[model samples]
Target chain A: MIDNLLFLAAPITVSIILAGILSYLGNHILTRGIIFVDIAVAQIAALGTMIGLLLGFAEESANVKMISYIFTIAVISIFALTKFKKQVISQEAIIGIIYCLALGTAMLLAERIPGGSNFISKTITGNLLWVTWKSVLSCLIMFILIGIIHVIFRRHFIKISDSKNGLPYSLWKTRAYELLFYITFSMVIVKAVPIGGVFFVFTLLIAPAAAATLFTDSWKKRLIWSWIIGITGAIAGMYLSFTMNISNAPAIVTLLGLIVFLFAFIKLATKRIVSHNLSKEKGS
Target chain B: MTGLEFMFAPLVASLLLIFITVYFGIHVIEREIIFIDIALAQIAALGSAVSLVIKNISGEAAGHDHDSRTLLAYLFCVGAAFLFTILKNKKIRIPLEAVIGIAYAVATTSAVIILDKGAGSDVHIHDMLTGSILWVTWPQIIRLSVVVVLTGGFHYIFRERFRKVTLSYHGVDTGLKNPKLWDFIFYMTFGIVIVEAVNIGGILTIFAFLIIPSSISALFAKRWTTRILIGFLVGGISTLLGLYLSWNMDIPCSPAIILFLGAGLLVAVGLRAINKLFSHQRQSR
Candidate 1:
């Protein structure tokens, strides 16, 4: 039993590290008002995996990973260029539509190709328990590299995320900043998506950051709290799933969901209590 | 009656969806929740997947049909709408799209997990996404027709109220009495329509059906009546051509039909571009 429990250590830890990385991306996503880009990028990466399978590449091969990153970065570049523009159809609508298109096209290709169905399930609901140390080691290396790059050019990302849409295209600085942000973010997504899948990645990315916003006005403090929430939620979810025979992905997702709701409730209740006390004092 | 028996049922089913989706699509577009159909549809499908896992674990054979699944789906979809309506109370708390994206993430992940636990989950999910509308039964068709007609009647009667609620109160401080109730009604009717739709069609085809027709029409049509007419016209043309091509090429029905709609949209865009150039030339002359 102890060994069985200990075996879950690596996967859980990797998920925590993943949470730390993606929570920052989640912050940018929330700030940008484009929350669904992760899903779209995740789907496009899955499409890359499908394309790899079509080309006879091994399921977890370097070639497959390379193709996935290439596809994701290209898609992200397109988004960086044009998606922020004002359209008769809104930006969120376009993101949502692109999401469906990616999903449909991926499903069609998976059905038509052999050995593709396996990739489909892996893409949608990844096997978090089955992650090997070799894969985890590679993830650690990639995560460290991406983290260093992000820290080095963190200010550029800040400038890009803080910039409002509808800026003139002639300002190459703004355009370059936006492209830099997307490229780095895509790297983060391509690394995390294979193990955790879209939902796991997205929940880690958004929920902690969203919950943190209620507590802190400072981005620095929020970043710290986001990591704390994500790490705690992931470990607790793993424990509960192990004890209760629940699936891990859903377990983490549901717990994070509950965490967000709990934070919101607390925020609401505190405001009410304060207002109620103030009114009582005035009446007296 | 002829060798085209398989195509006939799917054709009838697609026609019914085209009728209602063209109407609902406008509201979805106006509300800027273009993926609401897919979101609600997935929520409904998630409900059924949960029940299936429950039954399988308990080793009991409960009846699996439209009624049980639709009930669970409405419970979920409406609950979701309630949460979303509150989250989107327009006080600048959290953006509506963020809330929606979060809900969508959690719902879909829970669904995938449940489906993974239950046997034949892949088949179940595939059926939900790319439904075998080509092989729909008579009883299913009759049931769907009844639901759609009843829904159409309700929509026709309270059309103005829906228009008022969606258009007037879009992200504004409405402060009405129980606007959640109004949002509940919208999601409920939409749930009823799309649950019936998921019964015959799947998420992929139904999503395409809702958006593509109305979107193409939105490009050109001005009045509501003209838009709906153009929607029907395009839907009919696409269905005919898609089915014909599917029959000839032996591809899957729904994806082929989706491709046809996409093709149709591109053609519409191409024609509009040509028209724009010609108009510019005429103005110059």
Candidate 2:
């Protein structure tokens, strides 16, 4: 029983940490009008894994898998850079291209390589029940490190994110601000890749951040709310997955979606109720 | 024949198809209905799966062949596209996204089941995902070219009406109110996108060709005509480079092409940042 608990503990911790980091990065993405970049990046990561499998890399080679993800990030970053001029093209189109290209590449590669079908299938439709200890530990350490860094550099991060407001008069300057933004984004892609396997990462990252935005105007409050919602969704999803005997990633995504929906509904209801009360009071 | 002839044929054909897809994709992106392409592609894929099952059950040897199967798949895709459009108008009030998502999910699962049943080879399914541009036949090329020309012609004729309809939603009301025309244009675009998409590979190819190059071009070009021209250039370059890289390195073409586009975006961003920096430096100086 303890062994089973220990086994489950790693995945749960990783999921929560991932949820937190993704939520933070997702907010920045939304503000930049490049929200769909997450989806594109994640899908590209999956495609990379598919390519790894196609290239005769064993499923056990986590390092090779990581390499593929990096490749994906590189690809997505390049596409993002080139399409910087067109207002009409939009971020969503770039994301659409990423999705298509990744999936298509994975399919083509799978057809050629041995054991490619199995690799392709598993990568595309991930199974969370097979979470290993190594992945969990790496995720936990990365998450903690990121969390500490975020705490230390919170002000700087916020300033860069709101660069449109101009540089803040702080101990640090413009170069520092730019460095922090790039690092944070890179960390987000790296950490998110392993946890959600592309598709779920975007939802985990974006949904909580988006939900938090609806409730808070302050950056600090929004970040805190986003983290809280993300952790809550992760825990709930894991528990649900454990009880339901389903895949963990999908379960977490579904939970996050539900939470977003619920928040939206409650927000709508509260606004209506408050307005109704104000009108009644005025009438009296 | 010659290596150049063999190479240029597929490249030219793909370029024509990519052009058509990009134009329609731009409109789709502007409307914020990107998922419609994905959903329709999945529906078409589902139609292919159903066709495969029917052929298997009928024990039809000819129908099971590659050429025949592809033809059948195309027919089914066209049929599904029409059916989907009709269903959208039936007052069921189903959100287009939801319908497309559900259909895609169902189709994917069905494909899995059909493959498991040993009805069709896995290679066939893979073909549906990543198209082989090197193998595009002459007839297919002609078909795609005709579709591109027709779609472009239609867009040109209705350019004023389209601009009016799109802009009129902003409350200035461009007096070009014709609900039927809107429906006709959208359906035509959707139909052409779906058909051309299946011919290329599936929704992914259609989507990449449709949206990526144009979106990237938008970053550099200000004018609409210039944007389109640049987009076509980007698309054409990516296709050629992607094919070359894939052939040389023995990697998948689609991702390579996408990665190439991504590199372009990064370069653009870098240039913009440099421009800003230079302007700032000049002001200080």
Candidate 3:
């Protein structure tokens, strides 16, 4: 039992690290109301990986990594360029279009390459149980570095996401900042996709942040609650995966989904009770 | 079958797919729930995966039972549509789009887990993603048409109510009664169309069919009939180009079509830009 539990340490630790940066970015994405952007970028990065494989590059090689990074950077630049204020077409539509085009192209490539179906499935669902300690440590260092960058630009990032206020910087500077956020965000996605798969990355990014939003209004408290919820969900998911003999990533995602639902339910129940009491007080 | 005979079913299937998907896509864009089709597709995929697992447990090969599997998939999509209706409340703090995104993630991961228990998870996953548009059959085309006609008829009968509910998003109060009821109807119909389209075109092609044409139409027109007309022209042209390219180059039909649609979008964007530039020049004179 101890050995079995020890075997889970790397995956759990990787989940914790991912949950950290993902929850932070999740707050930003949710605030922006472009919630699908992460998955879209993740798909673009996966398409990049497919291109690397098609070029005969090894999956884990630095060259393939660079190729995916380049792909995501190019796509992010397009997203930034397409950011229009007048909103003739919704940004969500643009993101969806990019996602489908990328996915379709990837599917096309996957058809030709040997073992391509296996490779695409691995990228989509991930193999969290087989995560190594070396990858975990490397991801930790990279996430910490990105976390520092976000910390340094927190005010600017936060202000830009505040829809009520005009941008604090000039149009060019704001675009630059937006570019910075997308770059850092895609960097994390390109890394996280290999570890947790696209679905896991999306769940880690959205679930806890969404749950935290249900209970709190302030950013700080929301961040705190998000981390707490994210960590709890990760640990609980790992535990369930071990006991139930299920795959790790889906277990984590399903638990996070449940946690969000539970939070939403609690919020609804409490509001109902409070309103009930208010009606009684008014009658008195 | 030789030549166009081989391509006929897929061509008809794609046209039928465009027929309903483009209509739904316009509504999706109008409502700003752009990713909703993908979300519903994922849910339907999960439902199908569940049926596969059920068949496996019952000591039968998983892929044979089409009727129950499709039914289950439709049921899952409708359930999700119902949930989306509730989550569309204005009082909810989290954006409905976020909720839909979360639903997509959860549904996909759950499908992965369920399919993992089966032997042919990879093939199933690939089929769910890319579909077999080239190998589409006349029967499938017939089924898809029945669904399209039924859904189109439903929308036509209550077009006014459905229009008002979506317009409500822009703060336009047409004073429609029980907008939630109409909203549920709209999403349920949308969900049904997606499941059928996904079966024929795969998720990616169905998405392309739904989004690309409608989006291109939005570039030039505002009225529903005009927009859908342009959408059909754009979708038809891209489908023809894609099928021809796939036939000539021996590539997968669905993704090839999707790429062509994407190219069309690029061309449309360029045209819109050029139009804007010429108008600006005219204004300056």
Candidate 4:
């Protein structure tokens, strides 16, 4: 068992790193109320990689990165344009449309390429067991860089996401900050999607933060709780994956999802118990 | 068979899809639970995956057990709908839409985990997304039609109740008797339709069929009947055009349908924008 864990050490470490940073970003996304934006952005970036592969570029080549960057730019532009003041339609509607479009287009392109279905399947669940220590090092470096940028502009990012801040939704400065945020977000997704796959990335990005929200409203406390929940879930998921002989990405996601569901139930039970005590005290 | 004859089954399948999906789409939009269809579809897919996993462990011939998988898928969809109904009254701090979105993510990943235990996970996952509309046969279309007619009859009988429940989203309670009961019925029927729709059209195509036609019709019409009519018109045209393109160009049918619906949505949005601009100018005058 120890030898098996040692063999699995690199993937476990990468998952831990992913859970930490992705949990932070998930908090931001939950606050923003655009929950599926990560899924949309990740799928579109994968589509860009598909485009590169269609043109005969290798998976992790510079040309693939460039194509993904262009797709990111296009998506950012769409988000900015669709952030209207009067809002003829909901932003969620637009996001849904874009997600389907990207997915459909990717499927079309995949049909023409060799091993395209396998490529997509990998993008969805990822190949976490095959990740090497060298790629883990690169992933860590990229996350640190993005983390620093978010830290430097923490206030602006938080304020813009706060819906009741009384600021107009369509300001030029808001657009610029939104663009900055999405650019960095896409950068993380470009890195994370390859490592964790779309499903695992989304789970890490939403589940921990959601669980944290059940216990507190303060952002700092939520971040701390989110990190704790995420790290714990990651370790448990890795253990489960190793012992059960299953794949990593889906196992981690299922564990994290169960954790969030369990937290919600715990919150409900406590609330009920406290209410019951209060009623008894009133009767006395 | 000739090319046009070959395209006929898919065309009937797409039109039959509009018959059920567009109506639920109106209710979905009215309630603004836009992602529910996709979420429910994912849950349904998860259901099939679980059954497949069970079959694998039981050491059976899993490939031939289509009926059990379909039955399990229906159970999952209705069960999710029941869960959503219960959760709505619990009034958790998070938005229901957000909860639905979370369910979507988790269910999708769970399916991934289960399907991985079986062979051909890649092809199965890809088919769940894009679907194989081009290869649909007459038997499938006929089976779908029977369910469609039954669901349509149920809705027609309870039309006023369903409308009342949907309008209650805007706080207009027109004597809704047992709102929870009505809500379940609506969702149960909705879930049933989604299981069949997802089987035929995949996740993306069905979503477009659900949202785009109703959204476009909503841009022009006010009354429920008018909106349904407009939705039918838009969807019918898009299906014909999309299937024609798929037949001639040999692209996948589901995506082609989605792209054409997307194009229709764009045109509708543009027309709405132009209409707004003219009205604003007139107000200024």
Candidates sorted by TM-score, descending order? 3, 4, 1, 2
Can you write out model 4's per-residue Cα lDDT over B1-285, one digit (the tens) per residue?
698788888888888899788898899877767778778887877888788888989998747778898889899988877766755534344445666777877787667566665222452345577677888888989989998999998999989999998887666858888988888888899998888877888878888888888888888887889989989988999889888888788888787888888899889989998999999999999
lDDT of 2 by residue, A114-231 (tens): 6665544443344345567777777667767877887888776666556543345442454455445544565566455554554467666667776787677687788899899889
lDDT of 1 by residue, B1-285 (tens): 474886788788888888988888777766766666666776777787776776778887766555666577778877777776655543335555666656766677677556656222353244477777778887888888888899889988977677666765455555555666777788778877877787678877877888777777877875777888898888888887877777787766777777778777778868877997999999999
| Model 4 misplacement above 4 A | A1-6, A55-59, A164-170, A270-284, B1-5, B30-32, B56-63, B112-124, B167-177, B221-223
Per-residue lDDT over B1-285 for candidate 3, one digit per residue giving the tens place of the 0 to 100 score: 488999888889888888888888888888878888778887887888788888888988655788988889999988998888877765568877888888887887777667665222353345577778889988888888999999999998888888889898776889899998999988898898888888778877887888889999999999999999999988988999899899998888878888889999999999999999999999999
Once superposed on the true structure, which residue ranges of model 3 sit more than 4 Å away at CA?
A: A164-168, A272-284, B52-63, B115-125
Model 3: lDDT to the true structure:
0.84
Who wins the TM-score comparison? 3
DockQ of each: 0.37, 0.15, 0.63, 0.45
TM-score versus the correct structure, for each prediction: 0.85, 0.63, 0.93, 0.90
Candidate 3, residue A133: how far the Cα is off, in Å: 2.3
Number of the predicted model whose DockQ against the real structure is largest = 3
Total residue pair clashes for candidate 3: 0
Q: Which candidate should be chosen as best, given lDDT against the real structure?
A: 3
lDDT of 1 by residue, A1-284 (tens): 88986899778878877887888777777766677777677778888878877788887799987888888788777666654343444555556556666666676787767755555555556668888888788887887887887788777776666655555444566667778777878787777776776678888988888888777757788789888999899999889888987788778987897678667767777777998999999999
Query: Which is the better candidate, 1 or 3, if ranked by TM-score?
Result: 3
DockQ agreement of candidate 4 with the native complex: 0.45
Cα lDDT computed for each candidate against the true fold = 0.74, 0.61, 0.84, 0.80
User: In model 3 chain B, where is the ten-residue run with the lowest total lDDT?
Assistant: B117-126
Q: Candidate 2, which CAPRI tier?
A: incorrect
